[model samples]
Target: MPSFTRRSLVALLAAGSLGLAACSGTPSATPATPAATASDGALKVGIAQIVNHPSLNDLRDGFKEGMAAAGYVEGSDVVYEERNAAGDQTTLTAIASSYATKDLVVAIATPTAQAMIQALPDTPIFFAGVTDPVGAQLVLSLEDPGGNVTGTSDFPPVADQLALIKEILPEAKTIGLLYSSAETNSHIHADLVKEAAPALGLSVQEATVSNSSEVAQAAESLADVDAFFIGTDNTFVSAIESVVQVAEARQIPLVVSDPDSVARGALAAYAVDYRAQGVQTGTMAAAMLTSGGKAGDIPVERAKDLELSVNPGAAQRMGVTLPQAVLDRAEHTIG
Candidate 1:
């Protein structure tokens, strides 16, 4: 896969952040100590999750680990309130609003982030695994967030995945992009594919779904395309099994933005670990809580370790065998 030009990468970053910014509030200065009272030994933290899924579960677990590492214990030093919206925007807003009294709120996924941005601009908010924080309008810039929100980004280098797809399917010419029309993260990947695909002699066909209910139909719409490229689309992700059924039935290879999706059925994926991204965000949150760093003062960080995951079952089902070179490079393989 070819590399993204500095300019294009910047553009993608910008778009992702702006989209997140749809929910915004005033920026605050970094705090001087842990947000919680040390003597009381309790920090009230609220977590608003847009949906209940395995990936989000990884984030929650990572967050707990990060907080524990920072000396916050579950039953003693910290109090946590968790809410899952199940992908309903109304429920998301309600969950975010309910957390207004907490010392801090951690919003997972773009929708939850957006809701928190709107409902609690004054309360410090940390985000994790978000694709484009700036483009989503959640913050101003990665270096100087310019708002009371900052965390870790799960924004993988899409260009590299595009290159990998071509390598896996040398004869592939038309790549189908299946994602949610409503998600800012999906659009970020779309723009990236548009920018990188032409250079590889591939054209992209887009199929949009607004919710999980429509994923099957949307994926089937790409039947003519040679292969499918999976973005970090929440809608599509929530229905991974269905998406795999449609793609595999058509004998179309699938590539995903996150490695875990590969284990579920995608042929191969070039991605960063979602739990690692959560841990990154959690580390920053812990720093802010323990070291007096301001949420708005710190820049959002990107995933440092990328992974390649392959599913032998998916490949076998599709009648495609990945060469040893590809398999050797994989960090994990699921059959």
Candidate 2:
């Protein structure tokens, strides 16, 4: 396993930023009030995101859009404050604590949600990007959170993802999983993949990393495996290109759980649309704000829109061929 140098990572990020800029468009915004106090009859909302990545960034943008669609326009109906922890636990704790004064707080990832749950035990908390709220212990149950928490879950259809992998590489017998051990969502997805892969005649091999800096090394450790399966792990997704560099070199097909990752060079993905998850979360939060209901009153929702994405060039680089049926079913395909 080769370790990535700081200079190499910087170059990779620079290239990624350029690619993102080329494809990025202005996000839609609505009129919302500046930050205000609850005493003024205005709604105060705080959003704490664990880190800045393409998928999480999209989730954040979609959240604001969803809020606007729900009639809570920013700069008019609601006072919104957004913060990012940059994947630091201490920063997340500070950000969570700062939201204590807010009327409602929306946490974007598992870690941030956990921080909010700890810092604002009684405050209304809406969460997104969480794969398993119950497993993370953020809520008692998905149906009735029974606490100051309820939101959308980004739980990927693990079986569908694995089936896609098998469909692309029917001769594959071992599937490699690259994920972050620190993320509860990663563990949940990894467990599901492990359980589901066996039925597809695939054995699971895992390589865990604690942060983006370790992703290259972890991915390299799994070089001998037949294919790589990346779940919706924030750490891995944040540094996907590094994994792509190795996968392309080794000709290992990379299948991810987020469609956004496919555009980043992964071979394919069959999973939820994270931005839609944010919209669902925001809609639930809007209902609470409108009815003045408690957070616990809303049931935790799952992302309803699932789509398949394939990258033909990526598949070719990884030495895998996508069948016509799979291509026909894909909502999006990148050449």
Candidate 3:
């Protein structure tokens, strides 16, 4: 149920859906003014995301949990209008446009955040999944956003992840950097790896993809690389299974920036808990809306609950055996 995407998620499994679930709210089309609520005075919260994937799905769930923790229980004081663009740019714009009139919008990814900001300059937006928010220009600054946008940042701990890759694949030299070129955060992650790799005695070979369809080809192109490291690019993570298939077929060690990919069949990750990130974003959003704090006035948060996760089975499938020390270091492990 959590794996399905978008409007389909609602029709088929809204009762048990994950990312974009149960969106039922009514608000005036007057766009972004405060005090906007549903017909019954419930907060009209819009849940928008670019696509449906494990981490993003957890993000959506975590947001609701966070909001509840902040005393805005769903179906009680707050109501929602959830929308997933399903990776379609046109649909993303439509979702953002619709969210413009809501009291608040929680954008689950960078692309969705960008669309929401563009469509409703005055709307309150709390985002999760953006690695480089400042570079994406969703906010003026993390400390002082200077506008109607502020939320949590899921910047990958690239250096740590790279070091983990090196530890897991000691003889590895050139590492493949696979990501969606369209994601600015992916670029930022790649650059971070390139910048930090040499110090750890590793080189990078990049394979930039424009969309999910290109993932397999991009990965196959980097077949000669000793190992592959993919970051938090929504497009790339959304299509992680393709990369996993290629890795197992070629026996190339695969490391990813997303911890959830471990369950989907990646070796390991040093990642900020994305669900925790959503909680952070939702808490921030609730504070702003409830306490009358301006979006700009709230400081943008950087995710800090980092966890090291590993899949022993994935490593075996990728033709590598993890050392006991590696397993000991992991905060979580999958079969």
TM agreement with the true structure for every prediction: 0.88, 0.88, 0.88
Q: By summed lDDT, which 10 consecutive residues of candidate 1 come out lowest?
A: 21-30
Candidate 3 per-residue lDDT, tens place, 48-85, comes to 88777889888888998899999996775888777777
lDDT of 2: 0.80
**By TM-score, who's the top model here?**
1
The order of the candidates by lDDT, greatest first, is 2, 3, 1
For residues 1-335, write the lDDT of model 2, one tens digit per residue. Answer: 12234454354334311100010111222222345543466688888777767778777878888889999867668878888777777667777787788889988888778889989988999999887777677776676777899998887788888998889888999988988767777777787889898899999889987777788888899878999999988888877899999999999999998788899999999888888878888888888888888999787888888989899999899888889999998899998
Clashing pairs in 2: 31-74, 32-74, 32-75, 32-76, 33-74, 33-75, 33-76
lDDT, residue 90, model 3 = 70
Off by over 4 Å in 2: 1-40
Q: After superposition, how far is residue 54 of candidate 1 from its true place, in Å?
A: 1.8
Q: After best superposition, candidate 1 residue 275: deviation in angstroms?
A: 1.3
